[model samples]
Target: MNLHQESSGEITLLKQKAFNLSSESIRDEIVSSAFRHTLAICQDVTKVKDQSKLLHTEKLDKILTSRLFGFPIMLAMLGIVIYLTIAGANVPSSMLASFFGWLEGYLSLGFQTINAPDWLHGVLVLGLYRGTSWVISVMLPPMAIFFPMFALLENYGYLPRVAFNMDRLFKKTGAHGKQSLTMAMGFGCNAAAIMSTRIIESPRERMLAILTNNFVPCNGRWPTLILLASIFMAAGFTGAAGTLVTAGVVVGMVVFGIIVTLAVSWVLSKTALKGVPTHYTLELPPYRKPQFMNTIIRATIDKSAFVLKRAIVIAAPAGVLTWILANIMVGDTSILMHIVQFLDPFAQQLGLDGFILMAFILGLPANEIVLPILLMGYLSTGAMIEVEDLDSLKKIFIDQGWTWITALNMMLFSLLHYPCGTTLINIYKETKSKKWTFLSFAIPTGLAIAVTFAIAQLARIFGWV
Candidate 1:
């Protein structure tokens, strides 16, 4: 044969050879072989085994990553982190709220001095500004406190062990084990969590992670959940007992979210995203002392700012709209009531009032502004509501006909609702499919409505409400 013909034959043979090989098993065997060779070389040249740090890490790992003790320790650590975040943010949040309220008074006075139109003043100060201020005051403190400590755990390498611990559970749902990492990241921010799904090698598994990331309440929802739990659920209790009970409720919500995530993943895997789960090895690194200050600084700047900036940007417009809704007249009633009235019948079926439902709709941009919008909807005085204290806020909700069932449903809906605008955009960007983006939105929202509706009906039937 001529030279060109000979080259074509060689290329065709290589293609045939590659076609015969199982792609999954091929790289795995190669990696296994490489590790064996590297180990042999290390054994040939290296000495002084049983290094101190290595020994300590292994010993700790025995308990921390053990099948028996791992789950309990993980739960305990979660409770501790949650408790610290809740306790630490309370004072700073109140201080920020008071400071902002003081600043708002000056701005309002300036508007009055300028003789700005009443409409203009109300829109600027009450509608737009209060919305953003509540977001900052409420979201900033907990996020600032929660994320840095989360970063510390990350820097110290405990997060991967968390992934290791959750691996089997995820696999049973036909998801990649590394989805646990994305889920953990979701505790901070769902948009960031969706982005973190890049670590999952399989496209199917990554999609699973992206779709379910919102099940776990993000940082924005934490303040609302904690406040509701403390105010309504822990009504008859006080002191350490009340605090623990609230924390337990929060943790239970997380566990419930995980179960819902797994159930959804399993259903999706069986139907829409049909595939067998592919396994990958997870490398557990030796624990090292995290750089305390550096971790704090990065988490504060990177994480807090990431969520805060988006919340503020969305809060501005949402706040203005809420103000308009509350102020604009329809006959004798405000336009807010008109919309709320339309939604109330349907909302009641889900154990939520129209004001609560409207808040969630407006909060599509950012979950941080939900409570503020809801408060605005409930107000008849056209005065800005200050969520400065849990007691006052709880009183307002109670006045609005809120009960434990309402609180329970609120938490459930918040946990399972559609992604925020930013997160939806991120999901679209990651998936590059309008279809998947819509499904990601539709799936959670439908589930939320159905679940809440069922709970509401069951509660009524059993007279639990």
Candidate 2:
């Protein structure tokens, strides 16, 4: 201990402490003292006069991420998106169907005039015609309506708010905030979503994103979900309520999809790719006016065309295969029915029959083609059944023993099942490993089977059918 006294004391005695120290150490101590003293002075000078006038990210975060309004606002926005898509798609689809139907008729007449061979006529006129036309008619309208609005939202910088909204739940799953961004992209296309996983730097988190990306129903599956939900779920209601209810169910499936995504992410993170979420900042840009003309042009011409081209490439072969399956017969049963029968046992165990399952598998080449193939299978009834609208389509399903349970299963399966061909290829390319690609495919498919099985078995036990 050292005793010391200073400053106007009667007897000031200073105790001297002796230590062996290098000159460099003494200089370092002096420099540290000076630096801290300067910082203290600067801090005192810069202190704010009023705390309430402070502006920072925290204030902005409170308003955007408030518990009182965040989820409700999210649902409202989702409703608006679906409502716009449904309202905008109807007239365009009808117009395109009429134009394509005329073209098919013209091609048939031209073939007749040329005395075309039966096989030639069937292959080109019927197979290609029906395939390409169905793709164009069914796939085009939704893309046209959904993409521009999505792009506008993106361009306006609302995407980061989406990330902010989903971050806490995602963090619980040990996934990165950017995973939400990739999932949002999946709503446009799963392939694109998988590609966007590049933003996530961690291998474990990136893999989780890749594996669970398909949980958000992509644009490909939207038509099937929308059509079925509109037909079976909301059929009793009429007018505005019907539209709203249909949109509501569609949005509900979207919400359900997001839930499945988070659940799957949590499971995968804990079981296979275990880790904690690494920190990353999400910048929320100020909202800006969406360029009206450019938004539409880029959405339709660029985004829609890219997806459409992929669909066409996959759908053409699928269409021909579907046609063959419908036309060719073995003894008395057609090849399609034979295939469906082969799948029946497995499908029935899950509450879905062979035809429904087979159609989905075949349509994996493109989800847009699933309904078309199912239609072909139904129309091949060796009768001229002209399906005009949603009601007629529901009748076909009803004739095939589709209860409300079937409709429910169909919607769930469409939302949770395996992704399209492009997504499969994208997975393989992104992972650069066959193992991961297989896992990506198997995981969702396994969930789909499990969920469908539970729903079906429960319903059966309760005699809900």
lDDT of each candidate versus the true structure: 0.86, 0.79
For candidate 1, the 10 contiguous residues with the lowest summed lDDT are 24-33
Off by over 4 Å in 2: 1-61, 381-386
> What lDDT is obtained when candidate 2 is compared to the true structure?
0.79
lDDT of 1 by residue, 341-368 (tens): 9999999999999988988998898898
Clash pairs (backbone) in predicted model 1: none
RMSD of 1: 6.4
lDDT of 2 by residue, 53-161 (tens): 3454346556667777767777788899888888778788788878888887899899999999876777676776677777777678888888888888888767678
What is residue 135's positional error in candidate 1, in angstroms? 0.3
